[model samples]
Target: MTTQQAETDDSDGAHEERPAAIETIRSRRSGHNFDAEAELDDETLEELIRDAALAPSSYNLQPWEFVSVQDDNALDEIVELAYGQEHIAEAGTAILVVGHSEPETADEVFQQWADAGRMDEAAAEETKATAVGMYDDDRMGRDYGIRNPSLAAQNLLLSAHARGLTATPMIGFDHDGLAEFLDLPEDKIPVMLVAVGPSGGEEPERLPRRDVDEILHRESY
Candidate 1:
């Protein structure tokens, strides 16, 4: 979509400015309250989801699925499922992002990696063979379920930002209720809810962040 940006002090401050990627990172904020009237176009929405699909996941499983709420009546119904998160109602659209690790998806992805020459052939074959084979093995089963989908969600958020759209990553919603509302199959697990729309007022104030020195360590904390 439209790349036209109303210039701002933080963005126009310096000529030798931060790289776009770094700038996007520094400026990104979690938008909660938004103008419900500001809508996104179909072309822009498609690009946003495509960019999200670029995120990396364990085994390239890409286990995430999304239901984009378009109908006003449907959005109102889904908002109720989220326990009346006002933002969900206020947003132009809310995406029900679900995580599912069906053996079939994992198998399909693993095979693609092998065929694409990105992964070692023998290793891919072995991973493919053992992937679903290990589904019942206890150790790997639980691990893959979380690892693949979390990466996918992160990709979605960043893509939303890059597209000039803002989003909220919400864990506060009721998952079981949302699944029933969306009629999601039992195989798909709801992980997170994302509300996508345009700016409401000012961009959200940046919350405080921990310094790397405090959060990370060279070898030990």
Candidate 2:
């Protein structure tokens, strides 16, 4: 991951900037059109993925997987699955964010912590036991499966924006169709579709936002 350094402009009219992290989050918009000819390199994509994977998860279970579809032929099929969303076809890459509910992954997660000296063998064993016990319940497992991936998807969007790439989260697709199209494993669930690329032109007009006064509540409702 690249560390974003603050840069100062020499012009007299320059203003102090927000931290890069804050600026990136504030600047993100739902981009609908993309320059199809512009291609994203694998290294940049990997960096974005790494950054996204750092999102918090329950017990560090990290159940999500990101699949990038960049081929024209593959994208054509995705367009169909996405109900013919033109952006899917025009965007340089379509990222499938997938997650699964398997408790087996917990073992690996705990083992990694043990190997890294973050936890001793006894602690790792205890954590594994607790994680497996909780996730063995069908309802709890299903909740973690969906909830953790959604958090990771947000991280991916923010990371893409921070990297100077435009991305849009799409939830309008046929989920089963996308699963089959992507040949996703039966254990996995499709969380969201993100289309990333350079903008086709100027971004669309900014939409309105609700003021904090509309959402904030003092103490309690």
Candidate 3:
């Protein structure tokens, strides 16, 4: 096994020897049921999201936004959009990951750089222009819009896992219905739904993975 893969295995009874980060990741499982009485307040949810926002994005633009679904009415709507998945409303919170494909993010980022003395106003303006030009292109904008949000979603899942919370990243939902439910702007795109809460029972059996040799290519396929 590779060093990372070896570190991920705890079957040898060296659980305490593994790094905390790896242990958190290896132990995390997608929870199907949550303790309804267990609650995650807005402050705690925001704290988790703060760490998730630190996830890397192209140009450090941080193109994602999260909507914490806590209200019963909103949760019901999301459950409908998600094809009546009971877990949608059962989790303490369902964070919607949305990505922006507009020049507005570039404007905000460049302006911040200028304010922080990281770049001169002129340089910031030039950089914004270049970035806006690239993001204005249909394919590139769509690619970044989807990919950046996905990165944030993964970060959120890991962050929640680290915080002793169970989370599931779900993509099986009606995208257009969710967009309408969230009242997203034209430039915003819904990318993922993350259900998070305190652990409920019924952890599924861990599935076997392909051998490293089968997946790792020497140089190229």
Candidate 4:
């Protein structure tokens, strides 16, 4: 990803700098209008997914998976599945953020932690056992599955924005149809779909946000 230079205001003879990460978050807009001709190459998409995978997860299980749809035929099918949201086709690439409903990676993750000296062998094994036990309940496993992947989805949007690309997160698709199309295993659940590409026309104004006082709660809601 390219680094964005901080903006300076010479008119006031003052220098005000903001972190690129903050700037990317503040400037990101959900855009559906995209340049159909503009293409997102494989390398760039892979980088974005890598950044997204850095999002934190419960027990660090990192149960998220991504399905990238870039082929013309696949995009067309996605548009249909999404109830004819043409932007899925226009963007030229759509990422399906999926979550695994089982802590299948716990063994490998804890083993690595022990090997890296982050945890003693006993402690790592104990922690892994606890995590596995908690997720053994079907409801808890499903909740964590969806929750963690949603975090990755947000990171993906920010990653795309940081790279000077436009992205729109959508959840309007038919879940069963998407699952069938992707041929996902029963343990995997579709969480969100994000369309990523360059803007085609003038971007709409940023919508108003709720005031901090209205949304923020102190110790309790």
CA lDDT of each prediction against the hidden true structure: 0.73, 0.84, 0.83, 0.90
- The best-first sequence of candidates by lDDT reads 4, 2, 3, 1
Summarize candidate 1's per-residue lDDT along 129-195 as a digit string, tens digits. 7767866755466456556666666777777787677788887777888888888888777777888
In model 2, where do residues sit more than 4 Å from their true spots? 1-16
Candidate number that wins on lDDT, 1 or 4? 4
Clashing pairs in model 1? Answer: none
Write the number of the candidate with greater TM-score, choosing between 1 and 4.
4
Error of 3 at 32 (Å): 1.2
Runs in model 1 deviating more than 4 A are 1-16, 118-123, 137-143
**Each model's TM-score, in the order given?**
0.83, 0.88, 0.87, 0.92
**How well does candidate 2 match the true structure, expressed as C-alpha RMSD?**
4.0
For candidate 2, lDDT tens digit of each residue in 135-216?
7788888788888988988998998887778889998999999999888988888989999887777787777777778989
- Write the residue-wise lDDT of candidate 4 on 1-221 in tens digits: 44555654334755456677766876788988899999998899999999999999987899999999999999999999999999899999999999989999999899988999999999999999999998889999999999999999999999988788889999999999999999999889999999999878778886778777899999999
- In order of listing, the candidates' clash counts read 0, 0, 0, 0
**What is the per-residue lDDT of model 3 for residues 97-123, given as tens digits with 9 covering 90 to 100?**
998887567877889989999999999
